[model samples]
Target: MGRTNLYIHYDAVTNHVMTRAINFEIQDFPKHYFPQNIILAESTLDFGRFDPQTNFKLIRGASEIQVYFESAHKEKMRISNWIDFETLEDMHGLTAQEIAEILYLFHANKALKSAFFYKLQNNYVYLTLPNGLNKVYYRHVQHFYPRFQRAMVVHMSELLNESRSLFFMRKAKVQALPLEIAEQVAPIFVNGLKVNFQQAYVKGSRHFVPLDIVEDELTLLTLDQAPKNHIGFIIYDSNAEKWSLELTLDRD
Candidate 1:
């Protein structure tokens, strides 16, 4: 139930409907700090009769025909094998929209944030939604220096969208401890940590950072809260260090 990505492809000319879903579960801490399991489910529908909104059963039924794997290796023994495309097409008759109303519904239903359709016949491409993943990458992630036990619970879900998101420094001051303790820690910090946010990916309707941090930069790429139309912070990462602020993500 942690993170999931779903892909659907339907060809009007060939009358082919292909859907793929990847599900991930969080792994044990330290050894694997993120979700690593790749649960794959694929199905071929007839496409003509498939209703974009009312056919929840069709989509949910496909979940029953799924397979689980510890890794992405195709040769790995699956918990359950996927049905062949040819047999699947013979069993179901579902026509999908060229503009992909299903994708819009998918986004509306919170199944996914964005998706792309690349038609095989004319190479005609269509996307029902734009990406938050690409937008977070280019955002200016500044470097910072802070002493121990200074984590700050910053908020960012209110600003992200499909466009560019940027962050720059503002003035802030901290109280100092005794001179003896101050000597143990560097009193004056320097700039030029030479840090930037790495590439981000979409997990369901949320964006996430997929890298490690240095001294005290935001590590997790996640939103503070869920927003309407999947709109929120431009970047899911925080510039505040773990010691400087506690990461407060509004799950709502």
Candidate 2:
């Protein structure tokens, strides 16, 4: 026989309560993924947008359930259940803001201490565990969801890593530019400066090195010393928001 799939039932009408099910093998699932089934059913009280409307009605009446996959590895799937709310209080008693808050808390509770929890920051709730472990919870506020919506979890890690790498490269390039220029310009002044030299040459000028000059000097040096992966530059003048080439340097 094939392995039996696990399931859980959420009763949205009953304080958004969840029904327990038999535990099964989910050990191989990735840390960032949450596997569960979501169902929407008919509720007479008109609980508003938080309650699944059209989709809920279709699934509740359908005999066959459809599972949709979503995740980094495309392994996540959703399961659905039928919901029934008999009283208006079950639907109308909670406002949209309240319903959203409840949902936020529910997801956060499940994601505590994981990368998924950190992604919740996009949803506008800062999740933190007091002990510095992987546990997380919502802040105490009147309406939390109004401030932040749910965050996209899968690409957040990639985006953050790329951002940090780009920032580091930019800073390193900026720092290297000035140093490269100074090295190139050093030879030009070395023989001529046989006379007295003072710290004022650096401290009193009040003129700092420009990045353009550094970049130009470095590019020329690289062409002369090392031809591998070398790049040349073309200088331009600004007109009415367009640049006219002042000079172009290409390898001979």
Highest-lDDT candidate: 1
Candidate with top TM-score is 2
Candidate 2 whole-model C-alpha lDDT, 0 to 1: 0.23
- Tens digit per residue, CA lDDT, model 2, 1-252: 111111112212221211111211122123232222222322223222233432232222111212221221144222212222233323445455544544454445342222212212211122222222112122221111111111111111222233345545532111111223223322322111110111001123121111112221212221222223222211111112111111114422
- Per-residue error (Å), model 2, residue 65: 6.3
- Clashing residue pairs in candidate 2 are 37-79, 113-134
Candidate 2 regions exceeding 4 Å error are 1-58, 61-89, 110-252
**Candidate 1 residue-wise lDDT, 171-228, digit = tens:** 3322322233222222111210111122334444344422122222222223222222
Q: After superposition, how far is residue 95 of candidate 2 from its true place, in Å?
A: 1.6
Clashes of each: 24, 2
Model 1, position 213, has a per-residue lDDT of 20
